[model samples]
Target: MFRPLELFIGLRYTRAKRRNHFISFISLVSMAGIALGVTALIVVISVMNGFDNELRSRILGMVSHATIEGVRDSVKDWESALAKAEKNPHVLGAAPYIEREAMLQGQRVAGGLVRGILPGEEPKVAEIHNKMKSGKLTDLFPGGFGIVLGRELAYKLGVDVGEQVVVYAPEIRATPVGAVPRLKRFTVVGVFEIGMEEYDSGLAIVHMDDARRLYQTDGPDGIRLKLDDMFRAFTVARELAAELGGLYRVRDWMQGHANFFRAIAMEKRVMFMILSLIVAVAAFNLVSTLVMLVTDKQADIAILRTLGASPGTIMGVFMVQGVVVGVIGIAIGTLLGVVLALNLEAIVKFIETKTGLVFLSPDVYYISDLPSDMQWSDVGLIALLGFVFSLLATLYPAWRAARTEPAAALRYE
Candidate 1:
């Protein structure tokens, strides 16, 4: 196989032993630094990607993509509203629901939101049925006055299935003496765990009829909708609102959780920039290594120049050498990062089991385990960035080597 003269010479220089071992050591250090930097970027970005995915699955799964509710208080004609929503091609399914904020008291007191859901239709709008930890969703019969509490909520209230708890509604009842808050005692028939601390600690479910009776409403509070594409919720909600017309309001999951997702996106961007600095620093090491190499190879450079080598070829030689170092580092780092990211969960679990140290606590982080989703796009971008920086770092030193005067360099010999 044939190779370019500059490339052959550059690669030869990379492997050659030098009188000063410090230069060789610095070159190795530069390669190692680049490798470490690339590895860190890959692992951290993958972890962030994993968190984003988990949030979408767990949070969105538990909430409706969009809701159509009465502007006044309750949707008296929710059936018609549901029908109209379902008529839209973008809507997957719709279910009626009643939501209220209440105080739950058992062994202790806790404040959270309560939702009235139809056991059969609930799965159409939310994934509560699939998340049940103990009892079945069907246990929440309309007239049975049964309720389902989230696992953390039940734990905090110190109650379990088959236990009774008191729920105080925010609505006030008019009495002969004065206005008083309405309260009801309910049997806990089921418990669910969504794995998100906020939802687990602040949500409860009951039959739709029980909610209507407890809140003194004639019909459902609103119609919850499931869309074909979650990202299209806002547009679909608006279209539904326009179609429904008259005192009908629309709300979507994005409206309620936009800030949270935005924060995650901002954090991801900031992290990418911050971590890129490490690769940048390592790239600077390439500059230092190449500078020292140029100084040590001045004699050979003069000989090559006298032997009819052009400045462009001399520049190509050093650039090839520096880029070779960067390419090797990037390849190793990418491989290590991918392996780590793919098995991050198992690795963390093993560490936790052996060390008995929990890195991500469900109570604090809303998740019990670390998640990792390696994106090849992210890996490719990181590699490209490192390569560009390494290539750039070679320029100044390579240019200096190219411009070296053979007359001046050979005078010292």
Candidate 2:
């Protein structure tokens, strides 16, 4: 259990009481700065990770991984397309859908995108069945003219389940007066909430047959496919399109939402680089602290050198001291960050409830609560970076201390 002389001396120097109280205060401040920086980086990164997961799961859950659309704007033979898509090993589920822009007039009027879905097959492709807030997806029936509205959309229209609404299709019919918009009255059979304002306030669903009748189409506009791995959606869609051939076009979720995720990624990187500056600044403080320490202990260093201590050993002593400070700060910060990240949702909720202040609104942010997903890998990386910065900061001051002229230093004494 023998320790290196340099390590022993470093530990003693770190623990020794300084005659200058300001130097000790600076040392404390440096440690606090590092701890603050590490904590911020961990918490922010974890929240970003949480947002990424939430966007992927909630958005992908409600939409298809890939879509096969007809070059003609309507897939006349969707059944065959569905069959072909399902035959692909990458595809986990496939469902036929017809989507169009429509206007709804209830207590109020609003415009939205309406999707036609089969009640039985819809659950396999989308999570609407599990996302119901008031009514069941089964409420949608052929020839019933029943429609499912998103919660926010329903709220905006002032309509609820079992209420009636008039739908105006984008298609125009020739009339005696002029071209009149095709319109129909429908019963609101179900309501759903997917926690995304864009989807919730701008989308509605109807039975496949009802949609076809309303749009005057014989079949679905396209087949939506769910893949085993969503990240591979683009590749799978391309391969499927090539396999199917002949006027079949493929689209993936990423194509539509690439910018959104890209923004998140870019913001995460910028925030990381920005927050890392805090650690860097604190590491620079360590250099200042060690330089002052070297100046204060010049006589001691000279005595040690005269007693046969090597310059390398002197450098090792200061390096060990700086590393000790960094390790302690990193450990404390990591523990605090993990605790905060793990319970971030609850903590935010509690704060909101107590202060009667809303951080996120369902109508604005799509999500109503803060989310956090701590990754040990991110924590490890932050800790390692802090250590490296601290070690680097120690080098110049330690080298200066190592190169001290013993004869000159003791001659002043």
Candidate 3:
């Protein structure tokens, strides 16, 4: 219900030359603060999003989307499980695996998780073939006793391709002397690096038959499954578990790594809240700016009141001015945030090139470069919050302006 006269006067006051230069300086500072806060928030959130995606891909590369295992020691009928899983419309592939904890000794001794897999069927459920740094996944034939080691695990055991390592299984064998740990010497056929410390430092791969002989298991311990959509893994696992009639236990990637993802999500929320305070502080600065503006225009307010302008009209004029200032700041911030987030990776690369500095190195970190994935929804939410804070800041100052009495304000004149 604002009149054109009020709008025109508000805009004129905003653009007119100000007597107090400090007010103008403070206004500029507030705008810059808002812009900086928004830019940082957007860039940080985008980087986090990129990191989340990268970690997910690398993890899923080594692990399956879902897994089905017998409630007992081993799945004696794993072939049946694999066949049943493959029949599901949502299942893309399935493979059987046996895993055990063992001590591996080359020149040094190190403990690692020993996983047994079928070379022919491994690629259907996992991407181990693509991650091989040396040797082929098919090199491990039955009775060959060939093993594949993760890069860090190989380093820890001081063994490489064509080298020999002794794997001391947890199983016990009664020998002529006494009960001894069953051990076997295996040739290192391959080395793979998944870049994650947990897997790279503690995982070993060998033929399924060799693992069964070493562990004395009748069959594979579990069946791994790949789904058409990884996000539906939990639901698919539940259905598969039900179809198997409670004989097997089912799990999905999310359940296995819930803590890892939950931590990341919690960190993102905390970061958002912390950055929002910056925008809030800048928005609240509008209070001081408008208060000073109202004081400076006391005589003007009196003139308008005496000229038949209602208190509500006077309030609208000042409100418009404050809103204009906030809108301008918010608009500039939104523009800068979007631009900076989209170009953050390139900007980081440019800085590294110019400064001869390496922010991330593949030798030391999983990700070797800065990554960004700007989401429009995040941008929209930030912009909306900024606008709401700005609007709230205008209220008190506008109300004070409306309370000005014509007689008292004009007395000084």
lDDT of each: 0.91, 0.89, 0.89
TM-score of each: 0.93, 0.92, 0.92
User: Candidate 3: where are CA atoms >4 Å away?
Assistant: 1-8, 307-309, 361-363
The count of residue-pair clashes in candidate 2 stands at: 0
Q: Candidate 2, residues 1-413: lDDT per residue as tens digits?
A: 89999999999999999898887887888888888889989999999999989987888878899898878768776777778889999889999999999999999999999899999998878888998998898888999999999998999999998899999999999999999999989999989988877888999999989999999988898888898998898899888778777687788998888899899899999999999998899877899888988888899999999999999999999888888888888888888888999999999999998999999986577777788999999999999988999899899989999999999999969
Better of 1 and 3 by TM-score: 1
Candidate 3 yields a Cα-based lDDT of 0.89
Clashing pairs counted in every model: 0, 0, 0
- For candidate 3, report its TM-score: 0.92
C-alpha lDDT (0 to 100) for residue 11 of candidate 3: 92
